[model samples]
Target: MNREPKAKSQEPQTSGRSDTGRSERAKRAEGLPFASERLTFLEHLTVERGLSRHTVEAYGRDLEYFAEHCHERGLALPPQIDEDCVVAFGPYLASKRGLQPVSIARALAAARTFLKFLAGEGVLPADPSALVSRPKLWRRLPDVLSQEDAATLCEAPEAEAQAGGRLSWRDRAILELFYASGLRVSELCDLKLADLDFQMGIVRVTGKGSKTRVVPVGRDALETLRRYVALLRPKFAGPKDEDRLFLSRTGRPLDRIAVWALVKRHGRVAGIPGDYSPHTLRHSFATHLLEGGANLRAVQEMLGHANISTTELYTHVDAKRLLAVHAQFHPRG
Candidate 1:
């Protein structure tokens, strides 16, 4: 879902001409190209643009690298950056700087956004970044677990199914929900008791930017969740009235890192090699549905994709199965 950017608060002002004098001196010592302006833009992205903290830090780091590039070449400020300067920096990032294509592309996007912001603020006459092409990037498909591997991973937590294990029901529910719903780690973590409707087999997931979508939970997942709520969750509840559906051993909401570790540990038990995380379950969920002939648009809605194009990636993953069907039935084959 698209959201309007939030506005950032202006920098605080100090009383007296003495403070003003200090500001001027500081700006002079920092040179005409003050890094503070870049920081102001970042603040605007956070408050006005309503960008996530992760995005803000990434953009800041990208711009800082660009600023360092200008410093080495004796450029005064971002306003002085022309199209040729940007074009030169691209090669510098690739060849001299030895950054990968994806990294360079991200850095270029950051530079372009900064330039656009400068133009919008009337700091620059035109955005020099507009003249340059963004670096071409190869899309890497997400690693998906095979159907057997997915089942194995889900079953790994069942070893704790024996009585006296801590929160085994909750862990099992978490695994089942991830495979059944295709939720991002953050979306899963954000789930609350009120968001679930066991009778209706639906889960209300708040996705990126607080956008809410209701996703259907499979019978198995619903059953697991019911078991968790009924038997295990009370054991983990704290004095505070937290309504989170899933809790850690500490009775607090589970963070993404902990979720990652859990998935990784289960992957080892399942005998699946290489890196695997919560997102792999999501990918496996989507890919499995597509392979089973689920409609793309329907899956898109369930996955809470703002654009259908993002959901098309699963089509690519299921293409091999499509080819097999064609070979089996097509007269030409």
Candidate 2:
């Protein structure tokens, strides 16, 4: 795992950018440099854990960033990534890399996962990252469109269709389903035809970590999807592309970037202010449900969140709105 710590005089000075103006000191005396081990760990994540390509890539990027930081300090990745090094990594990402709290926390999470994997495989005596506590996140609430704005945005595609634009049914269904199901962009793009149960108004969605959940679809979304499949999907889907639920004009499954652009385009047309992505619809869906008195656990299950704490963040949003209303209408104020 890691080499024994040597005297400060014996440590070599390394040239690299560091968060602090002072040169970074190596936390550990010696350790194995990341090489084949990093690759094998990532491979295990993909093959054994069933993580999606996007998640695998994000983990790889975070690990690489950490590795570079270690190299600059004349240290190596775990078991060299000791408690002190792991502790400093959060601040380094913030001060040096200018990453926000959420991004820094995510990077640390990646490092922790990697260290745990190495420890599990007997590559290290113990997990160094385990001794490091996670950084506190700011918990910035997601931006949500108002109900009127959401409805207007969802209808933009159909309005275009009424003006004789092709692919309107597909776009409208995409918007409606996003609001109805709260599926992640990747999950929506990867949805297969068989994933939808229109008769039952439910869709089987595979979310982060490849966890699958069945979410109910509203009648509006299901009706739009039914029309799209019957009318537009067949026109776009080629012989080889019939399995996917959503297709491009070229018959390939719609990619995440396309969905992003479509959301932004329609948001502008509907005069919704500020940036909005597919996830905005998801935030709106969850917030509106909570505002309407839906149970917290129900929303968690619908969003396929692994932890209830993650879903609890929406409660904060409701609290903030209540404060605003109280301030505006209270007679004493």
Best model per lDDT? 2
lDDT of each: 0.79, 0.82
Regions more than 4 Å wrong, model 1: 1-35, 71-76, 88-100, 322-333
Q: What does candidate 1's lDDT look like per residue over 1-333, in tens digits?
A: 221111001111123454587577545434535477787898998888776565676787677677767776788866678888888777878876799888998898888888898998988899988868777777667788889988888878777565345555777788899999999988888789999998899999987655689999999899989988988898778999679988865577876666777788667867898788999999999999988889999999999898998899888878866787899999985
lDDT of 1: 0.79
lDDT of 2 at 149: 90
> What stretches of model 2 exceed 4 Å from their correct place?
1-33, 76-79
**Reference-based TM-score, model 2:** 0.85
lDDT for 50 in candidate 1 is 73
In angstroms, how far off is 164's CA in candidate 2? Answer: 2.3
Q: Model 2, 1-333: lDDT tens per residue? A: 122232122222322233232223232211325856777888998999999988986887787678867877788545666778888888889888999888888998998888888899988899887867676767899988888898998899876677566767888899999998888899999999999997888999988888899999999899999999999888888877668898877687777767787788778877889988999999989998999999999999999988999899888988888998999999974
